[model samples]
Target chain A: MAVVVQFAIGLVFGLGLVIAGMSNPAKVLNFLDIGAIRSGGWDPSLAFVLAGAIAVTFIGFRLVLRAAQPVFGESFHLPGKTGIDARIVIGPAIFGVGWGLAGFCPGPAFTALATGGGAALMFVVAMMAGMGAARWLANRRA
Target chain B: MRRSLCALAGAAGPDSVNTEFTPFASFLGGALIGAAAVMLMATMGRIAGVSGIAVRLLPPYAGGDVAGRLAFILGLVAAPVVVMMVTGSAPDLHIEAGPALLVVAGLLVGFGAVWGNGCTSGHGVCGLSRLSPRSLVATGVFMATAIATVYLTRHLM
Candidate 1:
């Protein structure tokens, strides 16, 4: 039942990415184009997407957290880390650079796998490799 | 709702920078994504953080419920197919960068997501919704750097 629910959620999220035009890298690139934003050229359509998602989820969290426990799980699997370490700051900085360069984030990049062709494939593979390297480094440090 | 959002973004005339403004579609899709996130939390007590989920499925990092992770990933891939079948519209993909740039960008994103502990979906959306401070900072930093990078790449380069 849990697995099925996860799949269903993924489906909805994936469909949203496609319909929202997030699956297209160009849309993202355009949104990040600061010059355009400055000149009031092409307004960042994604700001709406982000705003809409955040607004709904913000309300949704308040409602859901009221429950003693999640409907299907015994406890919520939320991130517990609260410290603002170097990892947190530096990591996003690096990710932002990549995101700005390619306009491909994980969700949309994965969604792009359906017909992402060579570029998308290359990205996914390289991304996996990077993740592997990070894990190795973390394990070594630990 | 879409109109209001577009208006808020200053996308009123045909001369707007984003001439291909699809506020209705974008807002509807965003709402769906939000609904999915809420459903995941309410039903399963989980955060629908895509990078976190993807990392768990990778080798050496695979420890948690692998079956569930695989199922969710399969669903993500199937989404476009379902859309194409229903709406008969193919998504336009514009990746002008060559494989070298793609690889570099991919590597950076993967490493950063792991180090930072979340990606856009995880930190920017679900985390921010829950008012997580770490997520808030991460989102701000990433957005600032992303805007800067775009400026450098497109305008300066």
Candidate 2:
């Protein structure tokens, strides 16, 4: 049941990417070109995808939170935070640059694999390794 | 209700910044994702931080946290379907590589999500906004590797 939901979610997210036209590498690559945004000639179509994703999720969260225990468990578990720092700004700027260039982030890339392809596969693998290395280091240091 | 409201608003023309996540849309798509992440955390006590949930799937996360994780994941997957059903027309899509490369990319990303403590979505959107030191480092690594990978593949020998 849980896995099914996960798959469903991934599928929808991918579908959203498809609908928003985010599945295209060229579009994403174009987004990365800050000069485009600066030139005021930027194609803001990707923004629509972002808006749709955010809107749908925002609405969904409202319902999900109303539940004491999401159909799967008890109470919400959020990461702790006190104030904004370098991580907040620097992290996004980095992400924006990559996202702007590659045109595909991790989620849609892997999900695209379900339908089948190479670029998605490459992205998924490298993304995993990055995550693994981060975890190992965090644990070791802890 | 909300959908209709959005429709009414979107009808405002091209200046709105659709953020539709499609090459055909605008920065509004990114903004939407960002806003969604913020609203999600504020409402659900969870950061729409996907990388974090994916990480919890490993050995160390064998506890009950999986349920919420499952739900968050589910919502993401469901959104697209709902969109297609409602919109009638689906957006365009294309991948640059073949199957073999896509698989390798998937695994590498999975590894990074764990090591980075969160993927860009989790850290970049949620963690970074909240000022998490860990998210900062993870985001840095995400970019460095991506640039290096793209550079090596797209240019240098």
Candidate 3:
């Protein structure tokens, strides 16, 4: 049952990405196009999307966090770390540059894979490799 | 695709025809994403962070729920198929960059997301909703950098 709910959430989230045009690389690029904003170019539609998502989530978390335990779990598994560090800043900066360049984040990239396109395939492989490399680096540090 | 290009070509002034703006749909989609994250939290006590979940499914991540992660990923990949069945067409996915650039971008995103402990969905959506200070900073940094990179690549270049 837990797995089923998780799968359903994934499905719904994926469909949302598709319907919102987020799965489209071009849409993402345009959203990130500060150049366009400066030149009076196309309006970034992603802001609305993010805003909508954040609004609902902000409310949802408030209500859910009040519960002592999850509906199907013993305890909530939230993130543990809470410090600002080089890894926090530098890592996302790098990710942001890549996001701007390729316009393919993890969620959309996975959805695009179903299309069986070469570009999507290439991006997925490289992303996996990148994640693997990060793990190796973290392991070495630990 | 061509329509988006035209939208890009024109001045997005108030009077310019907004050909590519889909605020309603985007909002609906975003609402769905938020609901999913909420459900994940309410039911399983997990963050519906795609990048973090994906990384946990990979090596060197300790004591992760392999089955649940696989189910989630499978659900993600299956969404397009469901869309096709319902709408009779898949979403438009085009990458203008060459292979090298695509690979480089992928690596950077993958590594950075993991190293940073989250991605757009993880930090931007889930964490921000929880009012985590770290997520706020992460989102701000990534968004600023993303805007700057696009500026450099699209306008400056």
- Top candidate, metric DockQ: 3
For candidate 1, write residues B1-157 as lDDT tens digits: 4334533543221111243667888888888889888988899788888888888998754647787787788888889989888878767666655688789999999999888988999999999988899999999999989889877666554
Cα error, residue A100 of model 2, in Å, equals 4.4
Candidates 2 and 3, the one with greater DockQ: 3
Model 1 chain B: which ten-residue window has the lowest total lDDT? B10-19
Q: For residue B62, give model 2's deviation from the true position in Å.
A: 5.5
The lDDT ranking, best first, is: 3, 1, 2
DockQ for all candidate structures vs. native: 0.56, 0.22, 0.62
- Residue-by-residue lDDT tens digits, candidate 2, B46-68: 66656666656555664445665
What fraction of native interface contacts is shared by candidate 1?
0.76
Off by over 4 Å in 2: A37-41, A57-64, A85-101, B1-47, B59-120, B123-157
Taking chain B only, the TM-score of every model is 0.84, 0.71, 0.85
What TM-score did chain B of candidate 3 earn? 0.85
Winner on DockQ (1 vs 3): 3
Which candidate number has the best TM-score? 3
**Which number leads on lDDT?**
3
State the TM-score for model 3.
0.91
